[model samples]
Target: MLREKIFYKDELPVSVITANIVDYPFHFHDDMEIVYVLSGSIILKSGYYTYTLKQGDMFILNDRDMHSLERTDEDNMVMMLQMDLSYFERYYPDLRDQFFVVDMEEDKEENLSVLRNIMAEIMMEILQKGQGYEHKVIESTHNLISCLISDFCYVVNEDGKFQNETGGKTSKILAGRLNRIMDYMYENYERKLTLSEIAENEKLSIYYLSHIIKEATGLSFQDLLSYIRVEESERLLLESGKKIGAIAEEMGFSAVRYYIKHFEQWFGMHPLEYRKRYMGKSMTRESRAKYKRCTPMEIETAIHALTRGAFTETEDKLVLKPVIIDIGTAVGDDDNGQPKTAETSAKDPKEAGIFTIMERSVNDILAEPYHLLMDLGETVLAAGENYVITAEGTDTKDISRLSILVYNYDENVGRSLRKIHTENDLLRLVRHYDDEIEFLIRCNGFSGLYRIYRYRMDRENLAKKLTDSLNPEGGAGKRDMLIGRLTGAPTVTTNTYTSSDVLSVRTTFQGMGVELILVDRI
Candidate 1:
């Protein structure tokens, strides 16, 4: 038995192979494949169907279709054509959910022979690799597909009904019902779901629904649910900056422990460990290093260096002037020095601060005259004009704000342009474009989901324009509008910084984590 191969070589989305074999063990791939018997015969098993493929017989298997074959005749020769679904999707987008039916049992012998001949021609062209062989193979493939559509095949619709009859309506109906159930589960996996609830919604009896689901999927209802949950969790783990616990909760797992247990069982590694391995492969060493966690002093120093001139090692120790804004009086600072309310001090024209990065200790800067300088978390200087600073509140309960402080070196005037209340922990900020700034804010407080926001800066009025949210699932909500989640505050680094074009901000979510989000300036 050979392990399933999910990837193909040579950057080709399609592969054509002619082989002679005695037996082939069960295997699966995330690509559509056609097996055409050129000589002899073979017993093929795919899902619930088992068929004896004689000479000139053809069958098609869809993505994720588990199949195996055993030689019925000694001289078993077959031509297998495998194609990535995404490759065809570019031209045939609607083919995604439609299954190509090629069961020889349901096909006339004459039609089966036509498909076989077309497949043989395609295989020959692929093997010969002559001039214009690629085009010939493609033409032959199209011919075979045309024959299948005209005689042997029928398109399975979204409701699981065959557009053209080839028999097996009952089987198609059962499969369709199971598919609908699976679709429902995928769409609402974030909420608590049960067999009874699903049965009620589908108007099916609990016992019958359970039986059919097991029969159709070869997995019990609970087992299927667990599999879907685990799969979704894996996606979130790699795509979002959400912590393991947050992912477990979002997928409706009873606890993070169960999520970890099932994830490890399916992937052979813990979720966190999987993230690390994934990140190592995807991000470059320089990109990964940009996300290093910097203290408040380090971030402030970086800003100070940028304000003066180009950053250099010798100038890093050069203490610059500090700008202090009296936000405490306007918003009323709490015991931990966070604003008690979410109101911006910019509403009061008189409540702004103006100063420079001074040569003094961070502690000294935080004292009188600079008492209003909040602890900066992540800071970025864009075009050396706009200073975007993310304030890390004293604690998790501290709902912080993102301050876009603009400074004029020649005029010696600094003003807070936008003071938007970030309902969660302020993580990082980077200039996404010339007039836009991006902020990564924590959702469920500290160690939860990290979300990214792109705001267009209004230089004159110091206002922000909400452009778009780019999360796959959708935005978090009005208060958050976070496009995605992260395990924690990521090490963010600016990639492309152009005043006219969009700025690229690359973030490494969590140390040694696999998740990387690239937010582009609008």
Candidate 2:
């Protein structure tokens, strides 16, 4: 039986908008709208805000928000539905459901495409003029809503706090107040909103307001204000393309020096330095490490870190780039007289079959040649192979490190190798090497030969070697694992091998227990 999906507002009229890419106007709506992108991309303009939409993308706009759309020279199909506020209130019969919202962004290409296809089906029904087009559209919308809500539930339930936090009356009231305060901050952060002014806005004494905020968010009001300023500064730095001095002044910093100091205190780096390093990218380890876990400060730190230096406060320009890289297999041979290769290749399945049959021959020739490298403790990172050394965070430069490429190995083959190595006490050696080495596992490839790489830590020496080694014919099976650490999961072929195959390889670590994580094929 299909379950009825719960949407927040029951009494709201559902206003469906189907438009060709060219007709979309930059207009705001008085009704809550859920946009499901179809065919091509669409632009959504709400009030002074605009968001880009692509195939299968969903955007929810609040009521009375001014929004519009623009057509880009890309794929262009879109569907929009507006929910009447009265309908929502009648259907939900609960005010608590009105304020909560969910947003999801997926990086998994396959999953994203699947969602796009699902949304396309709904759009197709509307386009085809079907008998039950309205019902179908509504049903599809509910399905998408359910999927989104499921994701929201999964994420919030990870900490198991949503029920207690949102279910209690006091918590609900506090949450509403907090939301208002946040809105106020967002609206007036640029202007100085003093503690007394904020307290007056909240109709509470300064002390009580401070205590409540600390209890709720575990941050002092001053620190919270500073956090807001820092966050906005970071956004401006990445988006504005403005000068550091100007950005500091705009963010209400007393002076450039003061901004620099506070910015460094907030992110462990000066604003200019941060902009220089990551004006439009991800954060460094140092910045991520500065904050404690499980707090708004941590969330803010992670946000900045995840965005890296992409949004800079120095420049008031927004530059967001789509990051993509091809995950490929690398194969190489060491000085030993043996050759290393995987038994499959997704690119050429015909070759994969031949390699599969030759596995026994290859195994015989190589004879379990996986050597483990011992971890050299806290070796100051010197240099890495085939990498450009650039400033990372504030003080450190990036190093290209050796990486072990894990291709899809049949579960049986991996287990067999593990078993043979385990009986010979060689698994211990592999673990030791894993601690210092980094492994990149790819499940799409079949051949093991494409997964090998060799490198040293010294950049000057490593670059020469890497250049020589990465050349298609020359670098076969030469790269060692860099800064070896055992990767958590081993990529295994599904429907081909299972954990039963892995259980065949049992071994102990100095009479201690060890757990192995066998991953499902990606």
Candidate 3:
């Protein structure tokens, strides 16, 4: 079926993703598609050819090929890259007439290997969101197009066999004509097409059109139309959620029996059987519900792990706020940890309370058919004593930005004495506190050049002096746990790391505070 796909971002002309694919029904669009097996296996049907692909294998679908995907096992993951070739219309108007095909039975591993590597790099750049990664993806997409045209697309003889490069210009002309007809077949397969209809549409005589159709595809007009219609109906069987009779009628078949016969002719099974074999298996309610969008950090980790058994390494400015439990604890003391003055403390209770004047807006309450429940996550442990030394890896929506918010919320008796000890007589400590809290960030999933910006937001300094204070810091090898230590006021700093698998940020947190940390690719 001609299911239109609008799948690009910012006019990039290429849409790519690494997904745990289970099923994709038979459908065709104008874009060329490439499917690479990252892990496990998948059974793909392209046109009349069915292939069971294993890891490290790739298949290209062109000729506006009608294709579908089915998982062979539960753990299958695939990289689907779709390129809108119409983008090249500016440079090469004949792109639509070019028929791209790969002969798996032939010896073409060299070109295929090159394609795999280029695609891997593209995936890395796209997922990593490194500096200039967009440009890199565009450039690599161009390379992929070039490779496809030069290696996979070639003129064939009248029998639909590949002709030699020596065929030259004549081969090009014939190849263009064939691909043109193939494209036409895809665009109009849903209709009751005939030699007369095709001839009328192409502005050519019936005799000439018939000869070329056979010459180009080694199939007569009627045979080609039947093949295409049967191929396209697969989408309806698996995806439309419609009845067989309705699907047959929609696919331009005169009757359900005829549609079933044609389907069996091409795929070696009844349409009902094919649908039963795959429909409930994937793209079901359960599968859709199980699908979860991975965070950018998790995605980077996945891409690296899938491509190699290893690690790798974007930037946007995002400030991370550290974990600040509450400021109400110090209400008895001033910003300098000094007790309130006698005059300030002697005011009437109602007149001197924090919110001496209060305002609340009342709105009409509306009843609804359904009620909603919420989870306000567990804030405190049953015990009164608790420490707050932690490193949280954060992500910014679809961007390749990574951040860590670290803080020292250690409220033990000792640090409370060494640090916020000024108000000892005014406020009493009542929580379990460690001498210092420290956590390790395992960054083995990234590598390469990274510009690390240290954003040190000292909550106490700002509260005490109301000054512009941000402690900037610095890097670590892969898997190294850099403990965060709390200390004096934070200072501004930036460090660039050129090598390392990114095992650790190798950082520290000691005192008390809350803020976010960010890491961008360079």
Candidate 4:
């Protein structure tokens, strides 16, 4: 009867926790549960299988599964998420019909990282409880569930065996006949379905179809049918006051004794006992007082630790075929000992209008100049006024062009608002901004008609994304969980400029995000 405690949150269908789990007596609920090992290790005994899960490892237990946890040699911090399928399935429909598992034989490091990032965010959301926190938490809960359904759901391979796989194979797994057979079993579990009937429909012999069902699901034909029937009977037993014989007959069991036999085999109890054992004892806000709830600092630590490498998405990169101009060859006045691009070329070189240019930041001269600046190669020079950190590319003296990248780091927002989606949250980030940068760079020695290039990494006001993603009612709570599951890139553009012996370029960039300024010879 031990629950992750959905009743505490009341109407909200998603419950989450980040805790130091010591041990839990064997218990299971109707909600799907996921265990993500954050620190140390955990030992879980679910049904017949016991697994030792280390850091970054995860395990999923389907609805009504009888499972328990045990501590290992090391101390462990686990993040757990439980979703009430009875509420979410009303929208997703097929959500509760599928089983989810992880087979350690397959390499799932990527999947594990993805699962951790989402789980970590969910922990922060609940603990912080910021404005629109409920909406964001539910949205992420849906994302976590969709990942399980699409990525980790059990699937029968071509050989009619359950295998854990990755890389977009859900369609292929479900399209196979074995999947169809499994679907058929769930669809008609309440009614009588014989192997011959299924075989006839598939145009295969009863014997062969029986073999496929066993090999595909790891359960014999009759046992698999009973598995589905007994699992389904839980609702009627708990929801309705129907007598054992009536419920049994309704669930396609010919007699009361047979139904009781299947119920005991699956849930370790008969129907009446299951109801009496769990139904009467319900609804505690805490999963268990002994299970230490994580502090805000702990959750923040976990978020950063998890997002350190694989969790934060790879920065979008752009490979450009730049016109490599050897700046060293630029013609210069012999007396001045500096490149004179303006006098060498027939056309008059462009003046320093861009340096004095206003609001080129929004125009994306080099995209949100702030963030784009940081994103450029590596830190070469950094300085004062509005906290500047500039990165550079290869040496232009030896190569074609000179680039200076600059970006901003706003520490005011903190971890909770790291990935801001709500208008209120974004305003908190935007309102604190001093999004202006004015600097003067006087080109030393060489100078002529040089081109000013803006490398743009497009960063739109993602506030518009909320309109397309979240509903007008501010997300329909768990209904959004029924809704289904990374981009931005860099670009280069050439603008006019003229260089002189003492080329003084004074530029003013205004706005937020990344910016990269590039200079190259004609």
lDDT of 1: 0.45
User: What TM-score would every model get versus the actual structure?
Assistant: 0.40, 0.27, 0.42, 0.44
Candidate closest to the true structure, highest TM-score: 4
- In model 4, the Cα lDDT at residue 104 comes to 48
List model 3 lDDT by residue over 200-245, tens digit each: 8767789877776665444567777877787678777897689989
Off by more than 4 A, model 4? 1-15, 20-34, 45-50, 60-75, 82-115, 133-157, 161-183, 199-219, 234-242, 266-522
Worst 10 residues of 4 by lDDT: 310-319
lDDT of 3: 0.50
Better by lDDT, candidate 4 or 2: 4
Candidate 4's residue-wise lDDT over 8-88, tens digit each?
283457877788888775665657888888778988876545679987777777765556777887888887778888766
Q: Is candidate 3 or candidate 4 better by lDDT?
A: 4
TM-score, cand. 3: 0.42
- What ordering of candidates by TM-score runs from best to worst? 4, 3, 1, 2
CA lDDT scores, all candidates in order = 0.45, 0.38, 0.50, 0.54
Model 2 CA deviation exceeding 4 Å by range: 1-12, 22-26, 40-50, 73-75, 88-118, 121-137, 152-522
Q: Hey, what RMSD does candidate 2 come out at?
A: 26.5
lDDT of 2 by residue, 443-481 (tens): 222211111122212112222332333333333342333
lDDT score for residue 250 of model 3: 83
Off by over 4 Å in 3: 1-4, 102-110, 163-179, 182-192, 195-522
Give candidates' CA RMSD values in order: 25.0, 26.5, 21.0, 19.2
